[model samples]
Structure formats: structure tokens, C-alpha cells
Target: MNEKFTGIVLFIRPHREKDSLVKIFTREFGTKMFFVRGLQSPNHPLKKHLIPLTEHRYWGTINQQGLSFLKEGQTHNLFRSIQSDPFKQAHAAYLSQLVDASIDDNSEDQQLFDIFEAALCSLNEREDARPIQLLLQLKLLRRFGLRLNMNSCVVCGSSQKIEDFSMTHLGVLCHNHLDTDPNRMRLSYKQIKILQLFNEIKLNQLGHVSISDQSYKRIDELIFMIYHEQVGIKLKGESYLNQLYKVADQLKVSKIEGT
Candidate 1:
């Protein structure tokens, strides 16, 4: 049967000498792999659209037992800035990897697709993209039905005087419930507020919110810990992103010292 759908390319792998296996997360079909013959050729028509994070409309033949065959497609948004900028590219790659790891094959999830698209767009356009990336990770976790409760203590349901985040409990712990887990990470009130805001606010409005360096570190660590403990997927793109951030930080320090 032939299927037509709109999707964002999540990954591409070389199938053979000339053919490529393309994995895309589609609005109509959750995640599907297509075998594009001669995609490695310099002149392949669909080559450009096969890039990671590129949104495209695709028409392809579905194989009952194995890989699908791509017939044709047109790119919707190439996100040129994301492809050109190293920071954006790393973040975009990480997002793509996260989506690829989280979703199941051929399972249609329009909400997840929308979130992924919005994340790429935000990263491409926003000057400070880390908050946007962090927000998207939280949304992705929620979409997977693993959302952490920031409103109150998961153990005692107390909202007042929340002081720490318990990875074991997967929520905020009030001062009274702090002893429930000796290993719970202490959190400042401001950090708790930032986590709550991320949960409540929409992705596009993330630009308006300012995150301090400390808050960003706390949130980043929390999100990564949740993914590690709950999701159980190790993403290579994340390591690359960390390296990029380290380099960027070093450059910033050097520039400051030189002035």
C-alpha cells in the first residue's frame, strides 16, 4: 500500500553502498523507516530533505515485513540556521535523538510531533536555546506519561514548604517529607518555581522567562537524571552536546579575560 504523510527526519543510516535508511517521525505514522535508493549519490533528489530535523511531505510504499520505499517528498522547513550554527545543530541533534529513542514504531502521536517541531523552530530562532531545549525535554517526558509532579510532595501530598526533589519519588518533597529519601536533592524555592513554570508555560513563551545559571544547572541535572533512571536510554547526541557546551563556555571565559 502507498502512504503519504508529513514528518520530520529523525535519523538516517547507510543501508548499503548507495541506499540509505531514513527514519522519520510523522504526524500520520509515528516512526517509520524508508529505504531510499541512491540517497548517497550527490544528485539524489530527496537527499537534502533526508537531513535530521528537516520537515517534509513524503509519499512512499509501505512494506508489510520490512523497510518502506520512498517515492518522493518536498521539504517544508529546512531550519537553515540550525544546520549552520554549531550550538543549534547540537541541540537539534539531541532533540532528534531523544524523539527517536522515546517513540515506538508506526505509532501515531500528533502531540509529540507538534512538540518536536516547535522545539526545533524555537532552537533555530531563539538566542538562548538551552531553556527551550530543557522545556522541550520536560514536555517530552510528560508526553510519555512520566511527568514529575512539581506541585507538591509525591509521598505526603503536601504543597507547603517544598524543599527538595526526590528522583526516587519522581516529584517535589515538602520539608516534612524530606526524610523519606536521604538521597533526595535539595532545591531552592526559586528552583522549584522554575520547574513549576516550565510545567505550566507553553514552549513558545519560554523566551520571556529568564533562568539563572544555577537554576539551569539544577533543571538540567534533574531532567537528565529522570531520563537516565526512568527512560533508560543513553543518547550519543547528548554527549556531543555537552562537549559543545564545554567549548562554548571556554570561549566565553577566554573572551572575558582578554578584554
Candidate 2:
């Protein structure tokens, strides 16, 4: 007998004989993979509902491999902003990959699902989604038990504030408690607060807050460090971001010289 579910499609792939396999991030069951036979046919019930970020109510059955057979499903929300914008689409893909890679199979995380939904909403509406996404990723990593100690010194736990931060220590190393490590990056108070605030805010309330360029850079650095520490790899989109950063820096330099 097949079980039924309500979920958002996180990823999709073509299967054997024109069928499709979909990885759903569900509301109840965490993440699941389902097979939709004859799904490529235009008349197939689920054909149009197969796109990424498409939320659906699924009627399916669980099999021996934890795979489900899709009997029926209906679209919940066709997010026009996310589906229409190419850059937003790309960002969504990147975020999906990160979540997929970070989480293990058959594990249930309701909190994570909620976080993802909030992230998707933020992506659709926010003007500065990159910084928001970066903040979300950092918070998500911590929620999964990878806490980045941004407050005080990691070595001495002093309240002296973070003077210099590092990807190596995964947080700030206060001046008084600074070890002999020469590979640390310097960070300001503004940067440290932004990283901390990302996890602390309700998703909908993010609109009320704004970040400075310096704080954004710090969050970016912290995000890169978190990815390296937790995922043990670099994000594919990071090089392009780095190039953009270099270009922005050069433009700023040129403007400063002109003034």
C-alpha cells in the first residue's frame, strides 16, 4: 500500500523509460525520493508539478528501498518570482545542492524544512538575497550542530569583543587571547553582529534589518569558512562571487583616486 504526503520538490531527475525521480523535502517525512512513471507525457498528472520549489500534496506508496511510487499530486505554490528570475533560479539550485549535501538520507528534520521554506520566501522577495542566503546557510549549519563561535574569544571565552576573526578558528580570536596562529583574518564588531543576528531573527522580520558592505563581506567570509568546515568543500558559485568582489573593489579604488 502506498503512503500519502505533502511536500515541496527539492530536486528532480529523469528516470528509466521516460519516467522521473524526484527528491521531495516534505512537511512531515523530512526528505523522500519518489518515482513518477509516464511523467514525461503531457497528459501525466504530475508532469507540470515537477519543477524545483514546487510545493505539492503527494499520494504515494513506500517501497522496499524507501522509494515511493507517485499516484497523485497537486501544485501548492508556483512561485513566479523564483521561477522566472534566472539568477534566483540559479541561487535556488545552489541552495538545494547545499541542503541535499548537508543532510543525510532518511533523516527527519522539521526545523530544517521550515528554515528552507523561509529561505525560499526570502529569496523571492528580498533585494539582497545573497547576504540573506549566506546568513541562512550559516545559521542552518549551526542548527545541524556546527556552531561558529563568533562571540568573544574561542580560546579564553572573554567578553572583550572579537578583534580579529579567522576561517581557521571558525570565529573571532580576541586580541588578549590571540594564539600564535598567523593565518587569521581581521574582523570588525559590525561583521560579528551580523553573523550572530542571522540566526536570531524570525525569517519574516529580516526586512527590517540592513547590512553594511563591510558586514556583508564578513558574513561572506564566515559562510565560506562554515562551508569548508562542515561540507569540506567550496561552493561552485564562490569563484564568480570572488571575481565580482574584485571588480567592485577596483571600481571603488578608481572612484577614491578620482576624488
Candidate 3:
């Protein structure tokens, strides 16, 4: 018997001649691979709802392992803004792919589900959604059993006067302990504050994040370095995001020089 389930489509790929395979993060069963029949056909009913990064309710067979079968599906949120914009599409791809890679198959995590859902909504609603993306990445770090100590110095465990960040220690360092690691990176107070703000941000109630592009670039660099050294998972969208942002930065420089 088929039952109704809620899921956010992570991706869809052509399986054979006419069929396709879709990976969805279901609230009930975590991440699932559903075998979608005749999905390549133009008249398929569920094709619209099965788009990557959209949320939907579907009638499907729930299996403990292996591919499940989808009978029908309905759109919950198409994320039309993300669908229409190239930049938002890039962000969605990277965000969804990151979450998919971090979680194991069939693992039940309601918190992750809510975070991902809120992230999509935030991206759809806001023009500058990079802050929300950073927030998601920071929180998702714990899902991999990794946490960056933003509160205090990683060496002395002091919560006073944090002045620098250490890639080697994977946390902030106090003024007193800045020299504890020879590889500590000098960080401006603004960059340090932004990192703290990222951890404190509530995704469900997010507002216009006011961040200067300079600060955002620095913080993005720190997070990317940490993910590179620790997470070590090369996602398909990562390279695209890097290239896209690099081009965006160059454009901004050109504009500034022109003015």
C-alpha cells in the first residue's frame, strides 16, 4: 500500500531510457532514492514536483533499503525564485549537495530537516542569502561530529579577548595565546564578530543580514579552509560555487575601478 510522505528533492538523474532516479530527503525516512518511472517523458505528472531543491508530498513505497517507488507527487514549495535565478540556483545546488553528502542513508534527523527547509525558504525570500548559507554550514558541522570553538581560545580555553583564529586548532585564539600556534591567522574584530553571529543566527526567523562584502569574503575564506581540511568531501557544486564567486568578486572590482 502506498502512503503519503514529505520530502525535499535533492537531485534527479536519468536512470535508463525513459526512467529517472531521484534522491529526496524525506522527513520520515531521511535521505531516500526513489525510482521514478517514465520521468523523462513530457507528460509525467510528478515531473514538476520532482525538480531538484523543491519540496513535495508524494505517495510512495517506503523501503528499509534500496530504491523506493513513487506513484504520485504534489508540489509543496517549488522555490520559484531559486528556480528562476542563476545565482540562487548555484547556492541551492551547493547547499543541498552539502547536506546530502554529510548525512548517512536512512538516518533520521528532524533538526537537519528543519534547517534545510528553513534554508530553502530563506534563500527564496532574501536577495543576499549567503549569510544564511554560512549559518547552515556552521550548524551542519556538528552533524559531522566537528565543532569550531568560537567562544574561547582553543589553547588556553579562555573566553576573554579573542583576537585571532588558528586553522591548526580549528578555533579562535585569545590575545594571550595567539602565539601558541605558529600557523594562527590574523583576523579583524569584524571577521571574528561575523563568525559568532553566524553561530547565533536563527534560520527560521532570519532577517536581512547586513554584512560588508569584505567581511563576508574573509569569513567565507575561513569556513572554506575549515571544510577543506576537515570535511574533505569534494562536492560537484563546490567547484562551480568557487568559480562563480571568484567571477563575482572580479566584477565588483571592475565596477569599483570604473567608478
lDDT of every predicted structure (CA atoms): 0.84, 0.72, 0.86
**TM-score of each model, in listed order:** 0.92, 0.81, 0.94
Worst 10 residues of 3 by lDDT: 200-209
Clashes of each: 0, 2, 0
How many clashing pairs does model 1 include?
0
Clashes of 3: 0
lDDT of 1 by residue, 1-259 (tens): 8888898998889978998999888888788888889999999999887898789998888664577888889889999889888888888888888887778887788888898888888888887778878777887786567978989889889889888898888889998888999998787889888888888788867656677877787778788888888988668988898788778789999999999
Among all candidates shown, the one with the greatest TM-score = 3
- TM-score of decoy 1: 0.92
Error of 3 at 153 (Å): 1.4
Better of 1 and 3 by TM-score: 3
Q: lDDT per residue, candidate 2, 83-176, as tens digits?
A: 8875566667667767766677667778878778778877877656676567567666754567777666778887585677666666668777
Q: In model 2, which runs have C-alpha deviations exceeding 4 angstroms? A: 64-66, 212-218, 234-259
Which of the two candidates, 1 or 2, achieves a greater lDDT against the reference? 1
lDDT of 3 by residue, 45-113 (tens): 888889999999999898887888898888899999999987888889999998998889888777788
Once fitted onto the true fold, the runs of candidate 1 whose alpha carbons sit more than 4 angstroms away are 143-145, 204-207
In model 2, the Cα lDDT at residue 59 comes to: 81
Model 3 regions more than 4 Å off:
253-259
Provide the lDDT at 229 for model 1.
Answer: 81
